[model samples]
Target chain A: AAADDLAFHEFEEAANLLAETPDAATTSQSDKLTSQEHVAVVVGSGIGYGAEGEEEDDKTSLLQDEKPQPRFWTFDYYQSFFDVDTSQVLDRIKGSLLPHPGHNFVRHHLRNRPDLYGPFWICATLAFVLAVTGNLTLVLAQRRDPSIHYSPQFHKVTIAGITIYCYAWLVPLALWGFLRWRQGTRERMGLYTFLETVCVYGYSLFVFIPTVVLWLIPVQWLQWLFGALALALSAAGLVFTLWPVVREDTRLVAAALLSIVVLLHALLALGCKLYFFQPLPLDHVVPAPQAIPPSPNVLLPSSVQPMTTF
Target chain B: AEAEDSPGEQEATSSKPLFAGLSDVSISQDIPIEGEITIPSGTRAQECDSSTLNESIRRTIMRDLKAVGRKFMHVLYPRKSNTLLRDWDLWGPLILCVSLALMLQKSSVEGKRDGGSPEFAEVFVIIWFGAVTITLNSKLLGGNISFFQSLCVLGYCVLPLNIAMLICRLLLLAGQGPINFMIRLFVVLVMFAWSVIASTAFLADCQPPNRKALAVYPVFLFYFVVSWMILTFTP
Candidate 1:
């Protein structure tokens, strides 16, 4: 009787400890033990655990055992018993113990390690500089110089128009940059690749624009053909590069169709211009300006003097 | 003895399942004796407290709302849905309508037709012109407009003309020629102004041409004037 009293006192103390503790493992183990004891009671009866006759007997026994197990036993039982919640606790522990999620893990690991981060930024900056400078040079070279001579006013207007038109092309490039930056995950690399392709092509459009405009002005077939071929190759390259990344069939199909149409239009325009308007010097129709006029007059002078000798 | 009796009251208190986690057997067997128990419906084991369930649901709703809010904010504030509309489909119809109106007037005058009365052919011509202009405009500028800007352009440009035309037609039915003509001219000028503003805005930032392209506004005005003369003077 004294031993039983001592056991009961120890059990009460354990129960108090469990209730006060916030650890998930202890609580989960207690639940598992309670469930196991209930199962044992049901199994102990003459009827099978699932048998209808055993259910009533099991219920009666469960009710009798409803008095909470001694706190210490409950805590010990819970701690010893493994169940669903145990798996959850294990998972949490495993996750916390392991490295963090992607990119974040790398970032955290490198937080104090500036040496590791430096190369990445340097490479990125170099790439950015190369891309920007190369594009700007390409754009400047493609622009028609206004100093050449014949239709000076027209040339000035053309230059102005082309400059203004370039703004629209910026939108697509900006969109590509934004998308690439936003979707940084490896799984989304295809999307980023696609955006990059778009950006490259969009910039290429600036080169293409001057060529197309020049072709249109002279209505030259060969220039048109050459332009068309360039366009087709660029488009095909873009599609091929992006095919791996873009998952949507509809978008792929649409892109293909658009490319085909553009190619065909370029081809047809070239053919007609070359075949129909043969040997016409495109430059002859619009003479190159002799020189770029001093800055364009802010307001057309009221005197109405013809500004050019042309 | 008292400790033993304690179990009895507990038994009374919890006649229900203590840990109802896997009570399918007990449910299927014990329920029928209560009276032809159809499968105990909608009985889920409640391991979590009500507060946890409520908190989870609240968190889920808040998460969804936050996501939706972020998307909405992007569209409204930063992305500028309005600009998208203006550059795309919205401007197309307005351009089409104006072009068609001008084209019809030109064709009618070229054909030497009396312009005093409205003819079905003239109406058809107007609509067809409108459609062509819409197509060309869309082709050129569709990528420029945001969805919201398209809506604004449609409201400011297309809707007013339609309303004015409808009102003019109604006035004509009451045999009010002067009033109808005045309304028509007012609507036309307003439409013309809208076109000028829109086109100027569009072209202002356009890249410089390889050659001096004709000033767009003047060209458009000239076309309109020629069409008006043909329609008004041809008999």
Candidate 2:
């Protein structure tokens, strides 16, 4: 009878514990719901670090949309052209330097937002570099033999700047225009924006920086090797990156355009190396100082004659 | 000693009267002195007299010149980019650019049959143009920097190239020889690298991590061109 009474008490205790658990569970569940609400508020406020900044950027963009778009003639319109960050620029440059086998740099890297910043500067820098380095190689050659009469040619800078600018900008413009003109519904994939073409050309010249620097070494074989390597890399980069854009064109047109690109790049590389890095002609001596009449009497007559004629 | 002490004592007594006169004015005005008369305690005010105008002007000019010199020294041994960014000025750059252009410029009046060399304007334009374009490139690359600050650094970094130009000029005067040529080459190459390194040192912090190479390439090219001009500069 005692054992039965004990068993009954044990069952009552078990039932009491079971009854307390639901109350505890309900309170805990309510606490979780409240905590979740707090988390939602925090997220909503955008007080968090990484994702919040993105949210802020979105907000700014949305605000900008609310404002009227700037006209094309205004500075604000062009301001949008420089909207790339360092990582994006670097990625594009790297893509240009080393062309990936299967990647379309245009589609992958530059589709949404093509930038003018890299192309503009790259062409300018290349123009300056080619002119300066060309002059330097000539100077280096002159130093090896004092007998050779060499004057530092400054015209190269202007020439280089113009050439590079034209190639980087105008060629792209023409290519873009041509492709657009030829593009039809059937050949829609062949068209790339003018900026995209320029961007490719501009970034493609990056490999030449180190190559031109290497050209300073004065080794014939080494210089050629660098020039060839650079040309191949840059041309390959341009050709392959632009291949998909021209893919939908007829085989002949595509082939012709691609070959022209490769040819122009080669011509530029070869021209820079040959013209700028040419050795001093060992056969040519410093031209003897031209005979100017040392006599004041003779100089007076010549000077007076010019004045008289005028 | 007695004479000095007597005068000092007399001055002290006289200064007391000066304060006393101030207090008398306050008393006469009937402004109840709520607090002890606090003699407007400060260094005696200086008069803007004509006698010191020249001296003051000279002092200011000297100070500005000294600051420019300090900036030049800073470029030579660049420890921090902030030294440049803190007080960016175009003075050093202007001087360097002018001197470089003067050195590099081939005057058409010199009447050489070959007129292909760069004119003064060309060199000037290239230097300024290259710097402006490079700065624009950095700005476009989303670098957190200002235009003038970038220009100041780029311009100042031309110091090495200028020095190399000077050396090359001197070496050219020594007459052409293999040894002289080698020295010129070495100097030009070293200074070229120095210029690129120095500018990059100043510019590297402003660039984003991944695109440092992108930003630096232009600077490298800019200096390389200038150094090339320096190296190949024949009389």
Candidate whose TM-score is highest: 2
True contacts kept of 2: 0.62
lDDT (Cα, 0-100) at B192 in candidate 1: 48
lDDT for model 1 comes to 0.35
Clashes of each: 51, 0
Error of 2 at A238 (Å): 3.9
List ranges where model 2 is wrong by over 4 Å.
A1-94, A97-102, A136-148, A184-190, A207-239, A250-310, B1-56, B81-83, B105-113
B49-125 in candidate 2: lDDT tens per residue?
A: 21233347877777779999998998899886487887899999999999998887554455345665666787898
- For each candidate, report its DockQ versus the true two-chain complex: 0.01, 0.27
Return the clash pairs for model 2, or none.
none
After superposition on all CA atoms, what RMSD does each candidate show versus the true structure?
28.9, 16.4
lDDT of 2 by residue, A1-310 (tens): 9999986775555444324322111121123434333333323443342343345444334333433566998654665676565667888888888786777777767744687878877777677778777766756766665665666667777778787887787788887887787786454675677878888888998899888888898666577677788888898888888788778878998899899878878777766665556565423322122211221221123223121111
